[model samples]
Target: MIRTGTEYRDSIRDGREVYVNGEKVRDVATHPMFKPLVDIRARIHDMAHDPATRDVMTVTQNGQTNAIGNALPYTQADWWAKRRATDTVLDAVGGIVTRVGDETVGEMWSLLDGAEALAAIDPQFAPNIKAHIAKVLQADPFHVSANTDPKGDRSKAPQDQDPDMLLHVVKETDAGIIVRGAKYETAAAYANQAFTKPTIANWGDAALSDYAVGFICDLGAPGLKFICRTGFATRAQAEDYPLSNRFDEVDTLVIFDNVLIPWENVLFYRHTQAAMHIRATLHRYSAFAFVQRSLKLADMLIGAALFNVRQTGLDKLQPVQEKLAQLAVWRESLNAHLTAAIVLGERSPAGLMMPNQSLLYAGRVLACGQLHEMMHIARDLCGGQISLTPDAASFRHPDTAPWLEKYYTINDEWGAEDRRKLLAFARDLLNSDYAGHRLSFQMFAQSPPFAHLSAVYRNFDWDGPLSLVKDAAGLSDRVLGAKTLTPGDSSLSKWFATETPKGKAAK
Candidate 1:
């Protein structure tokens, strides 16, 4: 069922223990650091009900309406609809905000893909995954992800060091399993729930280890304390740092002190095989949404740089246009990867449509690995003015207003106010401390760069290249193994042959 803005806001006021900057947060929904993003998330909910946006934000299923972002993708059309819905939210919000909900809910779908494997380990957990996937469609809770744990020592096992460093099962009762540890999660303080699970680690040969666990954690549950980092919103004026004020998704160190996880909520536990499977394929479906955000960021970078160059009539210069072209190349490269991934979508183990994993992961690497260089290009195009511009307050002051106006105003068409606003935006997007955090978020948000490359290595069809080289070099038959190796048959025609997906409600 779809929730309204008011209902979504009211749901999070569950008296969850939360703190920021050493101060106790009385109410997350109204807190200065969190309210902007909370309101943006609420707006996303309202979009599902608003008449003009409802068509784009929600879908009908079995005569019932559900959030488009929460629906399980079964066809290529489902993916397209999901993409459109996310774009609609970002466009409406006027800034990029990851971890809102859509970017994270797909992680559950990844788990669903391994239901059969999980059932082999524990039959009870298989059904739990399906139930939770359906629950997301029915309940539409604001979901986020929790994976990174603060490991005390890399050299020691979780049992040797402080066990709490990595979240572990402390005890099991008839009611549920009590867990203790912490996870670094974004937007956990204000979100309704998180798909809490183990971080990347070697599980050893043990079949059943305490660290092998995954569950749906209710954020408001007792004994969960949200210790969030100090937010950028309260640190600066909105006019000077607009993106930080409205779009900073405050990350939190959620302390799980003997928190109870109901049996029904446990997706998997004490099964290293299950844990390994999840760790391997956790981002299969979610990477699409994560990479999509980079596409949007690329657009922002292009727009800011192009506008800057054109404002000063620098677009006519050879060097400036070349820089602009370079930005376009990066932007379009991302667009190509996203569009191609959807066009050549592949079916998952569970029969759900997954974006072609190789292309999707390769796209992720290109978008993230080279983002800082592109930002530098944008920073160059925006010039020294972005860093030197005075704040809005300085422009409004009696003594300084005239001087800023005289220096900032280029022509009658470009007034002082517009120029100042543009500079402020460019500065925040590329030079502010918040900008550095965003860059880091892109680099490691989905996983580290090495992990992303590892996904590419695992998904890419290596045999195709190997066979091509073998055939060209006239290699012996034994090198081809038992089966004959053939070159891959991937092209535009193959993608075009795939059936088009129907609308969600129609399906």
Candidate 2:
């Protein structure tokens, strides 16, 4: 069901403990720091009911309307619809804001796709996943993910160090299990729930352990505290830091002090195999949305840089054009990867469509690993003026206004105010603290760079290359006997053989 903005805002006003900048937030929907994003999220909910955007933001299912983002993607069309819905939201907000439900809801879908693994552990777990997926569609609550725990002392196990270092079960009661630990989650303060699970770590060879647990955490539950990092919106004027003021998604360190997860909310518990399975395929469906953010970010980089160069008539220069082309290459490279991954989508173990893992992960590596360099290039193209520009207040000040206008005005086409606005925008997009945080988010939000490489390694068709080399080197079958290079060995390798294009040019 689709909820209005007011309903969405009211839902999170559950008197949950939330703090920012060392001060307790009385109302997250009214707080100066969180209100902007909360309003945006509420607007996203209202979009499903508004006459203008209702069509794009929602879908008809069982003769009832539901948020498109919550719908499970069963066909390629569903994925395309989800992608378009996300882009529409970004366009409406005029900037990128991750962790706003659509990006995180797919985490549950990944769990849904792992029903068999969950079933192997406990029969109840698979049904719980299906119920949660349906709950998301029916209730349309704001959802987020919880993966990275504040793991202390990596060298030592949880038993050696503080047992609470990693989120583990302290005790199991008749109602549910009480877990103690902390998780670094984005939007946890305002979000309704989080799909809490294990991070990227060694679970060890164990059949059952308290540390290996997964559940749906209600953010408003008792014994939970949201200690968020200071927001960028309240740090400066909106005119100076446009992206930060409106698009900053404040992350939080959610402290779970013996929080209880009712039995129904527990997706999997006391099952190391389930935890390992979840860690392995956690981002199968979610990475598509995560990488899509980078695509929009790439466009923002190109847009800000191109407009700056063009405003100064520098676009005509061959060198400037070369730099512009480089930005386009990065943008389109991301575009190609996303597009091709969808076109070559694969069916999940549970019969759900998943973006091609090899292309999606390789694209993630390219988009994230090279983002800082791209930002640097954009900053260079914008010139030193971005850093030297004065704030909006200085432009409007009575005494300094005239001198600022005289210097900032480039030509009749580019007036002082326009130039100032553009410079401020470029500054925030490329040089501000928010810009750096965004770059880091892209690098490590999903996982680290090394993890991205690992996903690519696990999914990529190594045997195809191996078989080609062995055949070219005239190796005997005995030498190549121990490997699986056949087409039907795996679903992805099968797609690599049939769906993916061939020939040297294809490479």
Candidate 3:
């Protein structure tokens, strides 16, 4: 059955151990920093129950239609459907919320079904992992995949630094293995049912052997501690801060202290290559999906930017129009790349049809570079007004209202109070700390920009374009060197007009 927002909230009421700023949070659902985010998440869940969005947001399984939450396609057609569904979902929620939250983590768990299928290749671990996945599916459980280990020194390998810095198998027994170390920057682990695959592959040879371990453990499992980080959303109040209210689902560093992983829950162990393969494949698919999300976000930002310009009466200025046009170009370019990726989707060896990796990677790289420029344009166009806008309370104050109304109102058509509210909404878009966090998240979500660009340059089929150029230049064997090549071999050059040669007749 599709769960309502309230039902989702009630389900998580059980106290989970969440530590923030050296203090433990008794209830995340009630925490000011977490509540607005949770409320927004609940709204997403509710969308699945709404008649309009129910079909797009949910799928039938085990004789019931469960909220799709974040589960996407395993085939090319499925990928297209998933992208369409994702657009619907993001549009419904307003793009203020990033796709990397509880719902996203849960959807990642569903993708683990594919991982378990691969693990099944090893007869020993296959059945157990499959069973583990079955259990999770049956319960409609939430999971956060923790792969980023704490690299104490960026240059040092996991084994070179402290083995404990990376989550590794501390002991093995017939029942299972015990793991220790920390997983850094995991999103919403406190609210998840389990943390899957801590410490990504490539920790070290010794580190890799122990670190290749993968498993699912309860969030409240013994010795597990969630060390929360303060985000922009966490430090603000919802009534006064709408942006944080909708987007502030805090991410945390998860510390594992000798956490036990049952043998049945292990998908990979001591197989670093296999582990890396699993991770690489997952990144390929997941990153592709995230590009779709970034495109949707760009669309939202474009609309908001245009609205801001219109509100400020700069819509007709050629320079402002040029800025908006640039933003539109970035938005369209991203969408075009994403669309191409979807159209060229292919089937993975695992039978999952993922988007075209090259195009998707290009979309991601473009998103990183373009978003920064877009934000800069947004800030520049909005001017000092974004930062200096008076608080909502000031307009209501008897003493401040007169002066604020006289000077702050833009045009005669809009009142001082109305203008202030509009500015507040614009400030919500431009000046909020949530916007900064979102920018950083988008920047690092796929991979570093240079690495992404290298992947795109290496993977795209440049040979196709080069062949066209070769044919145009009469370099093809079909041309047979019948004529000497000139700088204007195909098209006429203004400086080198084709005149009848002294000895040869013009064709």
Candidate 4:
């Protein structure tokens, strides 16, 4: 079921209408704006078959192999494998690229978690979700999510404003439903399909609404247009903006113009409760992969800052070391949250393993909430030189080459060329337009800052802390109008079973 790199490339060449920077792209796999990310995605598929990486990139069950990222997580070890596979891909790519398959395939698993509720509301549509979940594993298509969570002008409803502002079911047919509206997606131009769904909105107790619809949208289907923001790849020399050229995941405003979602692909329709259920828990598993990117970003910060200080001998300064320590602290804080979430994992409503919700959400908050400040610290440690440095062309020019070489070369180990490349990298990672875009992307990629805080509020085990304080203060249960809360969190009870071998921790 696993696809080859070439197969992945051929799949996206299917005559999908794609435009970027006012030009219609004929081949996304080769277009300058998209080729880098497309090639990186292809490398991920190829890694699944490459002997050295296959063990980490794929899993086998019932004598069939599937991508590790596509397998449904059932145990802590499975999560570890998924984490490892994602890290392997990031390491291979040398820069962060969000919206690749691993980070998004989990959105389908969230639907699986809501299957019971979805079935209760609409029995006819529940089976479609389970089938698509299975299809993800067997077919191994590069999947992504489609939802900007567009908060339209609060004063006007969809009906008052443009009805097409929010993607809605225009009409249903014997074959399928035709959808109209648009979504901001990062990789729709090259991705195989998207788990299309409703953005966040007030359902207002409606039993049936046109806006309550979700589907498996074929990206190559008719009447779809991908209009992307201008890319950073060809704007400058790669040597001067390595990360930009190699890692820009082109975001697109995907216009779904009467696109058909075959009857079989419609996961839910005209069911507000089902839509609300999905909106509540959309990022349950996907957030782990999303936050993992911040962990890698932290690593990049530490490496870039540490190297910059070291090459300049500024590492000797106690003040400089403290700044580095702060970066390390933030980095390890992210690592600790991610690690603990896996070890303290919980079971989903569907009996699938979920990373400990509290720790995962908390990690997401920490990662996205303060990434800007961390980037600033890195920017400071990298020094003004990152911004003031001469371009690669200036360094290569005969007229200015001698001056840059004399000024940039620090030691025998740090040559003029190496110094120039390092400064360019630090600049791209911390100061370029792409840098700011990535910062904003992470902050709002999963949801807005308020949404991240809302998730933390919902997932944190408040009862455990409340019970601890109540016992300490000798408070009466009657005052709270509820039964006495237990000290142990019900979610973690299984993770913390009392029964165990001598001197061993419960799992």
lDDT for each candidate structure: 0.90, 0.88, 0.64, 0.89
Which regions of candidate 2 fall more than 4 Å away from where they truly are?
482-507
Better model by TM-score: candidate 1 vs candidate 3: 1
lDDT digits (tens) for residues 111-157 of candidate 2: 88888768877997677888888888899999999989888989876
How many clashing residue pairs appear in each of the predictions shown? 0, 0, 2, 0
Q: Is candidate 1 or candidate 2 better by lDDT?
A: 1
lDDT of 4: 0.89
For candidate 3, the lDDT comes to 0.64
Q: Which candidate, 1 or 4, would have the higher lDDT against the true structure?
A: 1
Model 1 poorest 10 in a row by lDDT: 498-507
Cα lDDT of model 2 overall?
0.88
Candidate 1: give the clashing pairs.
none
lDDT string for model 3 (244-275, tens) is 66666577788888887778677677767656
Reference-based lDDT, residue 265, model 1:
94
TM-score of 4: 0.97
- Residue-wise C-alpha lDDT for candidate 4, range 1-507, written one tens digit per residue: 899989999999999999999899999999999999999989999999999999999999778899999999988889989989989899988989888888888889999999988888889988898899989999899999987735477576666677788899888899999999999998899999999888877656678889889999999999999999999999999999999999999999999899999999999998888888887899999999998989999999999999999998999999999999999999999999998888777789999899888899989999998899999999999999999998899998999999999999999999999999999999999999999999999988998889888998998877777776777788888755766785564555634575332212234
What TM-score would each prediction reach against the true structure?
Answer: 0.97, 0.95, 0.82, 0.97
Q: How close is candidate 3 to the true structure, as a TM-score?
A: 0.82
